[model samples]
Structure formats: C-alpha cells, structure tokens
Target: MSQVIGTVLSALGRLGMIGAIMAAFGVGLAGTIYLSLRSPEVEVPDIVSKDRFDGEATLRDSGLNVRIRASRYKADAKPGTILDQSPRAGEVVKVGQTIAVVLSREPKEGEAPAGRDEDADDAANAESSRGGSSDTNKNDNQNRNQRSKNVNRNTVNKNANKNTANQNAGNRNANTNRIANRNANVANRNNNQNTNNRNAVRNIANVNRRAPTPATTPANPAGNRP
Candidate 1:
C-alpha cells in the first residue's frame, strides 16, 4: 500500500508541470498574432489640393510627395483633385513611397467652366478690336496713296506751265529784235536818198550860170568891113 501511494504522488507532479508548459506556449502564440496585426505609426506628412495649396511649388515644399496616377474630365476640376491614396490619408505608413494622385485634363468642346463669363467675353471683344484696327489701317494707307498721286499731278502741271511761259517770253523777245533791225535799215536808206537829191540840184544850178553869151560879136564885124 505504501509503494502505490508514492507512485500516485509522483504522477500528479508531472501532470502539473505539463499543464504549465502548455499554458506558456499558448500565451506566446497570442502575443505574436497581436504584433503582426498592428501597423507602424507615422505622421500624415501633408495634403495637397488646388484650392488649399494654390501653387505647385508650395505643395512640393511640403514633406508629402505627389504623383499623378489618374485623370478627371471636368472643366472646373480642370485644376485637378486628390482622388485616392494608399495608407489612407490619416493612417500612419512607411515614408518615401509616393502618394498617388490624379490631374484634370483640358476642357471638352461644349463643357462650361466654373466662374465668370466676363473672361470669355473679354477675349472675344479683344479679337474684334484687333480686326477693326487692321481695317482702319488699310483704309488710311489707301487714302495716303491717293493723296500722293494728286500731289504728283499738281507738280507736273506746275512744271509744264513754267515751261510754256518761258517759251512765250522768248518768242516776244525775238519779234522785238526783228522790228528794231527793220527800223534801223529803213532809216539808213532814207538818209542815202536825201543826200543824192541835194547833190543833183546843186549841179543843175552851176550849169545854167556857166553857159556864156555865145558868138554875138562875130556878125557885127562882117558888116563894118564891106
């Protein structure tokens, strides 16, 4: 009976030791699972949005890195927006992996953009103003060309009139010279005729005076001698 009691005590001690070992193993396994499920904590570096950041340089200056991953087709989002992200916005995550983003493309044909209609109207008005100015300049140039033609014609007419006046003056001077020469010739001829007439008259008078009483004495001498 004493040997049986001692054997039973030894077996009970071994069973207790085994139960303690199993419990320790179970606790270690549970701790490992908890550690695997937990995420490493990291700060949300920065968030970039069009209205909030306003400038590309400003967004880049922040610690967060941006990468365009997708595109949206709106004219207003025309600026673009932050659509989806990994590690989700507020949750902690490892650094250096780029946060994917999206950008907006140019507007479509008929799509209207958000904001003032005045900008579009202003562009149209400016184009119209430029067209009007070009037309005015062309008309002004044409008028200037016509004025130049008129001035040239006037200059030609003035030159022609001057030439004609000079020619008429030369003709008048020639006529005067001919008249003076004819008058001079007539005076010389009249002077020569007057001189000839006077010489002939003087010769006739001298001939009459010099004709002597001819031979009257010859008849008287013949009667006396008989």
Candidate 2:
C-alpha cells in the first residue's frame, strides 16, 4: 500500500506540473491574441512643411490616416505644401488614427508658386497696395484741381458782374448831372427876357404923359383969339 500511494502521489505531481505549464501557455496565448486584435500605438512622423502628397504617403506607410483639416493661402509655404499637423511629430498615437493637417494653396487665381522666396511674395503684395494707393491719390488730385478751376471761374464771373454794375451806376449819375445843368440855364434866360419887357413898357407910358397937357392948352387959346 505504501508503494502504491507513492506512485499515485508522483503521478499527481506530474499532472499538476503539466496543468501549470498548460495554464501558463494558455495565458500567454490569450495575451498574444488580445494584443493582436487591438490597435497598436505608433509614433507620428514629421509632416509639417512637406508636400501634401509626400506627407500623405508617409503617414499611410506609418499606419496612419490623413485628414485634411483645412486648405489656406500661406505666403511662406508653396501651393499644396503642408503647413501644420495635429499630434505633432514624435508624439505617440494609435495605428490608423487620423492626423489632421493644414495645407497651403494659391492665394488667388493664377498665382505663381512660392518656391522658397517668401519675402518676394510680400514685396509683390506691398507693391500692388502701393499702386492702388497711388491711383487713389491721383484721382483725388484731379478732383481737387477741377474744383479749384470751378471756383476760379465763378470768381471771375462775379468780378465781371460787379464791374458792369459799377459802370451802369456811373452812367446814370452823369446823365442826372447833365439834365440839372440844362434846366438851370433855361430858367436864367427866361428871367432876363421878362425884365427887358417891363423896362420898354415903362418908357412908352412916360413919353405919352409928358406931351398931352401942352397940346390941349394950345387948341383952346387959338379958338378964343379968333
């Protein structure tokens, strides 16, 4: 009986070791399956300032998806160039996670590519603004000149009217003075004629009164002498 118990105990020990080994292996397998099924973490690559197509390809190779967040004009960046990216470079992200990026495009229709000279674009824009300002100033100057000319013309017209009015007033004054002088001369001539007529009438009446008394006395004496 002792030998049989020893043998059974040894068998039991072997079974326990095998079961422990199997359990450990099963746990390891289960852990490996869970890791395989779940998405993995990945490092985000540097894509900023790179071409959009090239960066997209790089992101895809890194097991990431590209999400275009926005497209805008950047004076410093060329057309279709990547300007910025979310979850920046070297940051840990899950595999297949979307990397939102901002891209650069042409500022206007038919704009040339800004290859590397960002200052040149700024200069061109500044020059255009200056040109527009110059045009506005030129138009303003023209309008001012026109307004000044109109004012001068109006002043000249007013001066001409004033001179005409003064000349008319002078003419009227001269005519009035001439009429008064002519009336005074006519009145003096009429007064002198009236004085001469009164003197002649007085002389004729005196001569007749001085001769009539002597002639009547001579006729009465002649009748008495006969």
Candidate 3:
C-alpha cells in the first residue's frame, strides 16, 4: 500500500509540471503574437511627405476603424493635404483605433456656380419655349388662311353652279317660245289652204248648177212621131 500511494503521488507531480509548462508556453505565444501584430515603422522619409500618406488605408490595414473629429485648412499644405493628425503618423495605436481625414473643395467657388449653370439652362428652355410658341402661332395662321380659302372656293363653286343652272333654264324657256311660234304659223297656213279648197269646190258646184238639163224622149220610134 505504501508503494502504490507513492507511485500515485509521483504521477500527480509529473502532470502538474506538464500543465505549468503548457500555461507558460501559452502566455509566451500570446505575447509574441501581440508584438508581431504591432508592426514597426520608420519616420516617413522626407521624400514621402506625411500629407501624401494614405492614413485611411493604413488604419484599415492595421484592423482599425476611421473616425473624423474636426478639420481645418492650411494654405501651405494643399487643401486635402493633412495639416495635422490625431495619432501622429507613426504612433503605435491599438488595432481598433480610428483615423480621420479631411476632403477639399475649390476655396473661391461654391454652389453659386452650379446655380448659375441652372439659370443658364432655364434661360435656354425659356427661349426654346418662346420659339416653339411662335412657330405654333404661325402654323395656326397658315391653317386658318387655308381654311378661309377653301371656304371661298366652295362658295365660288356654288355661285357658278347657280348661274349655270339659271342660264340653262333661260335657254329652255327660249326654245319653248320658238317652238310655240312655229306651231302657230303652221296652223294658220293649214287653215288658209282648207278655205281655198272649200271655195273651189263651191265654184265647181255652182257651175254645174248653172249648166242646162238634157230632156229625155220615149224611144227612137217615138222620135220619128215627134
């Protein structure tokens, strides 16, 4: 029993030593990873100005976020050129720390120039509208004139037809009068001829009446006795 108890105690001591070594190794590995993640940097060389460095990309590459606090202008540096930074360029900031940037616009000109362009576009549209209205009015006048001319032409045609009809009726009346005159003359001439025929017949009958009547005897034997 004493031998078995001693063997168990030795095994427990070996297990505790192994756990301690594993814990130490884990702590050392965590420290090495933290140091490796904090990449070293050189003072930005003079050739590459701090202003031109892409702080946004640099921050994101280091697993950091970007936040903007405030912005200011400096004439010596280009408008967009970073005049100053929150965490100076090479500071060892935590992975989640943010970097902010400032953008630039034309200093002298603002939205007024855009407004002027809009006004110019509006003026152009107004002029075009006026021109369109003028064209529409001209077309309307021309159409009205054409309609008037058509109406005149139709009226003229109607008048001409009326005059032609009147002339035809007059000609028909004249022809009827001429035919009536011809028929009256022919009737008078036929009546005169009939009268002359009746007179001649009467004269012939009178002459026959004035002529002597022959006396009839009984017979040839009777003529010797007379």
Off by over 4 Å in 1: 1-132, 202-226
Task: Give the candidate number with the greatest lDDT.
Answer: 2
- Give, for candidate 1, the lowest lDDT window spanning 10 residues: 51-60
Q: Give the per-residue lDDT of model 2 (tens digit) for 1-226.
A: 9999999999999999999999999999999778766868999999988999999999999999998866767777788898767766897877887888778987888766445365344334433533444566889999999999999999999999999999999999999989998988888888888888888889888888787564554457556665
Show the lowest summed lDDT stretch of 10 residues, model 3. Answer: 41-50
Model 2 misplacement above 4 A: 1-132, 206-212, 217-226
- Whole-model Cα lDDT of every candidate shown, in order: 0.61, 0.81, 0.62
Over the stretch 1-226, how does candidate 1's per-residue lDDT look in tens digits? 9999999999998999999999999999988667655634455443434532343333345444555655544454545544333333554544333455444556668866533454344334433533444567789999999999999999999999999999999999999999999999999899888888888888899998998977755566556774
Better of 1 and 2 by lDDT: 2
Give the per-residue Cα lDDT of candidate 3 at 40.
57
Ranking by lDDT: 2, 3, 1
TM-score of 2: 0.41
